[model samples]
Target: MQSTPATTTTKYPDKPITVIVPFSAGGGLDLTARSLEKLAPKYLGQPLIVVNKPGGAGAIGWGELAGASPDGYTVGITGIDMLLLPLYGSAKYDYPTALTPIAQVAASPMVLAVQANKPWQTLDDLIKYAKKNPGELKFGHGGVGSFPHLLGEMFGQAASITIEQVPFSGAGEATAALLGGHVQLSFVNPMVVKEHMKNGTVRVLAVTGEQRISDPVLAQVPTFKEQGLDVILTNWYGVAVPKEMPVQVKNKLSEGFKAIITDPEFVKSMSNVGLKVEYLGPQESQTKWLADSQKLTKTLQDTGVLEKIKSQRK
Candidate 1:
């Protein structure tokens, strides 16, 4: 049985608690971590400090967390790429076993976008074009094994077409490349690309969710399944700490995050930036993570990306 993390009864954190981000300062993860820093201190009784350790698709920061003291003073933000990177050969981190989940903060479904000038207006149009052109159609993502990159693989299978993938260092760069016509298409998080979409820089072909967002601005955008494609992928964000943290500290961290995640003001602030608040504490969050990771790993295996990993494990 998995050992449960104990709630922190003894007040830790004589000084500031640090929240490490595995990406640059202006990315979505960095921005959300900063937003949480603004509110987390009130519930945890210690001011939160955000430290960026960007590199290796998040291996550097995650590696630092793995080596840090498990005293609940250090926790960090990880997303879908945390699970996909290993399979894609980007990193060797075993996220499922390395970090203990505290809570899930928010989730934004991926959007299949095309340059505004592209002739493809719908997913079907893009699919047809991809089938006709084979590997001519290109798409951009943050990195080789990032969520968007693997998501593009799933998309190729679901749409039964071929596409060339171009990887960037981060979403901001990927968005810029898409806008600059470096890539004709991209699978981006709606929250990150909402402004560009609204400004007419890119056209949203479909959102990877079952229902459209409540935002009036996305009312006309259809879902991928609605357009006859089968896929549901989201850029999920959450808080996690070193696996060996004491139960008391773990629960305190979980409870503190739960409080902030459900707060109206916190939710509004995150939503204002296009991140819809979705809270799942510890056990629930872990289950979701495991399930999603399993699905993603399975997709990788079936798609041949997991071939080397499987052989090594065997």
Candidate 2:
């Protein structure tokens, strides 16, 4: 009888993995990628290399990831903006379909805040003032189709108020405009304004999400739903590779990220940066991505943003 040849099982991630971040360095997405870089090695048995490909409102990097080989060596960190980009005719790749979800790592709720000296003390106060003032109140957002812009629009619609929107280059610039009194209010991540809130430079009126954030600094802030406005906006980030990667590679990547997100130290570090740890596996992330994409599409249509985009395209 001939001796049977021995089978060899290949180990996944025998080399460094590249993680593409679609935003500039030092941004939340980049920070998340960096954090994972530190923790992923423990589970993946190899270091993670983060590459920044910032441009076209995250299209450049995402497009690169979507077009990369499905060898599980290249993955990316993406957020809701990836879902909204195609709606605005700005994306080159189909989201959630062009990319395979590995796992969702972190989520942060947007906060509606104003200068500390502003008269509005609660969500009701702001709504009342805006209702009476109409376009008199100026609100700043990161950009035209940014997450904060969408949240501001949704808030305006829910409260039946007309407010002027001032778009800035980024959230940091928007927060600066708010501090300089260039805008009456702004919607931004709590982390962006947490220091200002502590110093009494800014006051958070409410947070946008289904429930209140658990952070000590934001525990007292009410949700939009608590104030009778049915709006939930959360900036979430997840890991994904080019679609059609081998199942074994996909499973390994997912398991590695799940481990990183659940690690005690990693969770604490995320919370310190005002990011809430919320883990969702591959299937769940894909489901949420599709649902959110549909919801945002309807919202843009209802708010006439879709019409504006179409008109601009012509």
Residue-level lDDT tens digits of model 1 in 1-78: 445467665447556889999877666788789879888768887789999987766778877886778998898998
RMSD of each: 5.6, 4.6
Worst 10 residues of 2 by lDDT: 1-10
Mind giving the per-residue lDDT tens digits that candidate 2 earns over 183-270?
9999888877887888999999989888998888889999998988877878898999998899989988888889998999998887
lDDT of 1: 0.81
Please name the candidate that would achieve the greatest lDDT relative to the true structure. Answer: 2
TM-score of model 2 relative to the true fold? 0.87
Q: Which parts of model 1 are misplaced by more than 4 Å?
A: 1-10, 88-90, 308-314
